[model samples]
Target: MRLRDYLRINVWLLPIILILLPITLIIFGSSYLSTPNTYFNTQLNDGWSVSHGDNHYENVNLKNFNLGNTSKGDVVTITSTIPDMTAPAAAIMFRSILSTVTVWIDDEQVYEYGKDFADKNLMLPKHYNFISIPESAIGKTITITFDVTENNAFSGISPVYYGNLFELERSYLQSKRLDLFIGIFLCLFGFMLLTLSSYLYMYHGQDLSLIFSSVISFNLGAYILCYNDLFNFIGDNDFYFCIMEYVTLYSIPFSIIVFLVSTHPELNTNLAKVFLSINILFPALTLILQLTNLVHINYFVTALHIMALLEAAILLPRLVMNIYRRYQSRKNSPDYTGMTSDSILIIGLVVFIFCCVIDIAKYNFFNEFGGGGVAYTGITFMNLGALGFVMSLFVFYFYHGIEHINAAYVKEHLEGLAYTDPLTGLMNRAKCMQYMATVKGNYALISIDMDNLKPVNDTLGHLEGDRMIRCFSDILKQAFDGASLIGRTGGDEFLVAIENPESGICEKMIEKLETLMAVFNDADKKIRLSASCGFAYSNEPKLTDANSVFIMADTRMYRIKEQHHEDKLSKFLDDIISGKISQKGGEEGT
Candidate 1:
């Protein structure tokens, strides 16, 4: 996980928030429990005159009260060690609209009422007696005339406890820059990983690799947007925010291109080209308008952010269809069928995207759902969801890569086992037909017969005759490879198919077979064989064309065989044996 990726993923909070939740409560125990402070020891005398002071204010009117008074506009401070509570997600709610402000031990004056500091970093501080001072009552800095002056003052303390945190953190935490960097790095890292995986898939045709690569790439773009601080360090925050928004929006469309390229039928290289060409110009335009203050909307950059998420959600149904089709084609493996990693990844991304949309809607458009009557601010939450989804994407990709490896293994074994003939170790008729269907353009189908093999099978051992047939098929396979798809169509008959017969592939095969025959029937050999081949070619469809191209070839072969004299089989075999030469010589001749 790189810093950028983490920012991209979390954007608002830490990754391990579930674990951190409890720890947060322990540290900020007082914040969760409605403070147990009783105004006792320090007594209060109502009014005082602070006709002068420095900073931001002068004399101001205030409601007077006693030491035990607990009302609006009361200024209270922690005089002793505060009591600790288990729950951290607690807040002191004032009656009406009062810009809630928090006075932290670190001198961090956070606005609890106004829009500025509504975004919270912690859920609740478990221990500490938080003095709730409503911002509505104080417009100016008044003097602390008496320990207890205002009607809402509480000087002493007593114990109290009301559990269950009411407020949820709605905003993304703008904490340490390091946290943001981690987030941004992780997303970018994921992007890099995705690019690597894409290359792997392109070369090796691995689905998992493509998916993993896509996820990483998506995260990378996201993280780049998240590392706004890094960008700000170089320039302006608003400028940085604009670039981030454009990138975030662009990633949505860009990811669609990547997804299609990785899985689309017929492979859509053009879509990627189109998106790349278009989007390269978009970010610059958006950034320029944003920097010039031309687009001064508070959540101007947010529109694109929401759009990206919406698009992700929209892509899910199409992906589901792809999964269904893939399963139909890959029917045998029911257990490993349909919508694997890609589906899961898309689902997670969609949910995360949707959540982001909600976040934007609540904060900017409408706050109807929950928290702050809009979106809750403070204490990171959505970022956790994003991180969770990212992790899921990682796992999905890892598994997908494994699946590709498994598929390659299965393909290799199947090619060796189910397709190749055991007897001649050549292609069976079924495999031959399959190969024949794939050949394009003008091609030849040939039938070869080894004469005298049947008689030899009856007179000598069938095993020896079988060996003779095997030898002839082996010779034929080597003779017509560039020109042939060879198979044993019968006990003593073999078939060969080749492409682009205009190159004289048929004649070359026959000539090469004759050479192989001579080598096979050496002086030391037991039984010699002679082969007859017949082939036909046509631009227009023959009765079989490619389907029965072999049958037509067989007919021609038989015509040649019948014309020979009865004593010719032995002589023909003798001629083949005598003419054949060394394996090296055959190679050189071919």
Candidate 2:
């Protein structure tokens, strides 16, 4: 119906179309990309033998193979025959966690990892091992040795795969494509939020909630990408990514706590302060210990987990109670709109906490009961929770922003009403006084008074008098268009102030006012309109302030009014003496 309505509808529709287009294409294209290349890849799971100290196991299925009663420094050896394959080049791929791996094909060493780190008592980074298989050794017996570097580091060997390297990599990445997309999206989104928050903080002086949100999103995204070995596909720097994984993991809780405390000040209790301090100090201490080789960063995972759970347990209930109280207080109020944001935040926090608890419980369950190892698939319930939480925060931020804008607009409107004159649409006396008190520098103050206003009101009615006043005010506004202030100080009095006026500017403005009055009087012959105006410059001798200049101008204006009365009286006498008016009419006007 309207152009603005059309534009608004398009604005809403365009983003949806843009978002769905790529998704539709990806959905259709994924079938082709996700088709498995079974001929080039094979999982080598069966017919493996394992040997430990004074023990041997045969026909071991490598999938979740239990390394019963293992300790640090205990060595386990696995042997299997390489499957026959006609590929030009092939490799064996498996993931190693906190262990040193050595592979040999018929007594010739092929690939080794973590040996140096293990020897130096340094923490070993987890990564996938892709050992190239010689074409001649396709049917050769392969001996794989795993030296355990930590207690219960892994209770089972991961399923190994024999495949073309590129094909194996492709398959692994295909399985994790969703994780990749979400992880990258979160990282980029976090970066954009971080940049936006920084600008608002530095320039606009906004609060820090968005900054904390950005940190939470970016760190969680990075942890997901690294923990699942998905980062290996992007950058194969195992040690750096491993460090990033731990650092980003530790940073998430810190950012989350700060965000909660900043957004809801009631949550910033003494206990919260202590947790905040610990979050800051503990991560730095662990990093120092890891760098100095005294202890590995991984050693504190359980402690970190416990601390996170404890922090949530202590703070979540307090937050819930606070939000509940606020909701109850405003339940019946007409302006109650904040509950939506509060509910979103609460839902997000609950989902995030639930996911965290699930992940922690699953980790402990698998490690203690199911096996000694946990599989990280890059995309977990925790990722979903993080996304949910961040989205909720974004919604809250936008809603809060809208509320702030609305408040500012209402405040500005009220201020305009307070300072404006209703009748003539000019600044009222209060605003004029305010400007006069603050005005500075070389300026001119023009005081204006309408002539014969009382006589006009008495002869014609008050309405005609009001119209005359309004007409004169319009003329003053036009004449003083470049002035700093044009105000109706009283019913028949007005003022114009100009700052740093050029030479002869006041004279030019006065002449312009006279010319406009002449034009108005010629057009509207109901009343002969006239006004007396006098201006005083701030730079003149003995003029110290705007008020002083205004007083001087008012004094001059009264003197001009007296002179106009004298001239009108003298003209009337001349008309009578020249017999231009009859003797009886002249006596009646007198």
Candidate 3:
């Protein structure tokens, strides 16, 4: 097989290894009783009796026992004899799926977990249970009875082990290491998702997919915290633990669906809505049952699990169809390349389904795979599956976020191009009109016309004319860089809107223009540059239209151009008359 195929197989094998390795070490490492001589240590799997809800059984081994959605109260009794009289102390270590447990040794109370049956308040750690053996009970027959009650968990009972006190303690701590490792990994991963979500929100306008992905991650982390019994360290409220589990479990499907919709937007379906409604409805019903004490929540959880399976069955086919349709569409399109979102989502869902199927099989068909009845196989697969789904979702969110940002950038650049003039790189007339139509308050509009642009183009070349227009545009931008708007209104006409300019600034601007023209004419003897400019401002509180002011300024500019034409004509007549007088004088001299 190729390396990638090997990697995939390895990933599937990892969870099984994680579960089995620690359990094997704990079981074998603590198998021998700690003593100066040879001693006997036993796992109390046989000769157990269980009674719950009018049902009774005898000689029930851990493998033969099943909880079966029973979450309220149960009793388990184990009768065993110490084979070695020389052994000093025997201790029992076991993990319990029950929320509350009370133990008695030969009718003498040994350990108590909670106050009473209905006192669903304090919760003992599910990772390990260590019960110390008294020195007085040496060489005696021990009858151990366990009073157990559970909440929303489907896990039934853990096998009991008897060994030396020191050996049992070591085994208890060793067994907890795996759960600790998984919990820490999940918590850190969830925190990373939260951090990424914040960055996406700030930079990418808070994409709903990323936000929902973060929520899903946090919910998963919290669920793991409760499931692995880490929450007992913070607080031992059984009711709160159950409620947290309910909330997290109820929110996961909705959050994932929301994330999916927000990422694709095309995959929104009635089935997703139905799944969301089922998730919400069941949790609310469970809460009502909790409040009314009508039924055990485990039965409700069983129903929810069935509904989840149905949802997965329905959702998986629809998702597959969506992937096929999207793939076909992209295959015909020119721009399609690389892995698509639907493809990634399908991979994730497939992995999740595989893991869930394994878990279901483990829970039903092969419950005694590892000899010890911890049911770690199913739980391990479930957690790994959830993590796989979460990682895939993160991948989707990352790509989706990038696509959104790129699209926004392209749109903004296109808009910038649309409002810009091609020749002069200035605002076009459309932009000018838009600015005039929306602006308020005091503003001055300057209308400018090239005086000799047509003559320059006709006598010289259109290139020179364009250069003149460009020069005028540059000068206008430099003078009115902070103006409200500056744009090319016509071929040789430019407009500028000065925001809140003083009355004297306009006159000073006109003087500056004249000075610049004189300098240009002196430096470039081949061409003379000049322009006629007019400006107007209205500070009236009820100004009707700023474009009207622009019209007035344009009219005034035309009037100035007409006056310059008349002045040039008069100068030409004077020069002609002077030449005639000089000619007449020269003729008299001859």
What lDDT does each candidate get? 0.50, 0.81, 0.66
Please tell me which model should have the higher TM-score, number 1 or number 3. Answer: 3
TM-score of 3: 0.72
TM-score, candidate 2, is 0.83
**Per-residue lDDT for 142-251 in model 2, tens only?**
99998888776766677688888888888888877766766777798899999999999999876988899899889878987887778877786888888888988888
Instruction: Score every model by TM-score.
Output: 0.48, 0.83, 0.72
Local distance difference test, candidate 3: 0.66
- Could you give the candidate ranking by TM-score, starting with the highest? 2, 3, 1
lDDT of 3 by residue, 1-590 (tens): 43233434555554685588557645543534323323445667776666655777677776556645444455555555533433446777666555555666666777765455437433333445567776566555655444555543433456677777665554444455545455566567777877877886788685656667778777776776676656654575655776677667666666766666676655677767776676767767876776676655544544656676777787777768877887787664433434555676678768877886776666654333343333444356766677667767766655454444544665666867988888788888888888888878778888988778888899999998888877777777776657778899888888888888887777777777777777777887776878888888766344468877887888888899898999989887887777965776789999
**Candidate 1 lDDT (Cα, whole model)?**
0.50
Off by over 4 Å in 2: 1-39, 50-71, 321-343, 376-379, 434-447, 450-453, 469-477, 482-486, 495-511, 527-529, 534-590
Query: Model 3 segments beyond 4 Å from truth?
Result: 1-74, 80-91, 98-100, 118-128, 134-142, 148-156, 161-207, 267-272, 316-346, 364-374, 434-445, 483-485, 497-528, 536-542, 559-590
Q: Residues 1-590, candidate 1, lDDT per residue (tens digit)?
A: 43223324552443475468546534443334333333211111222222111212212122221123233344433211122333344332211111233333223342333223123211111112223333332222221111221222222222222222222111112222323543565567676676776777689666653564455445544544443333433443433443553455545445544655565553444544564455445555655654564542222344455545544454555556666677566655623423455655666666665666565554443232232232122113335445546655665665466566566766776887888888898888778878767666777787887788878888888898888777777777788777557788778878777666766667877888888888777753678868888887745365545666666787998886775544576776676788644544788889
Each model's backbone clash number: 60, 0, 0
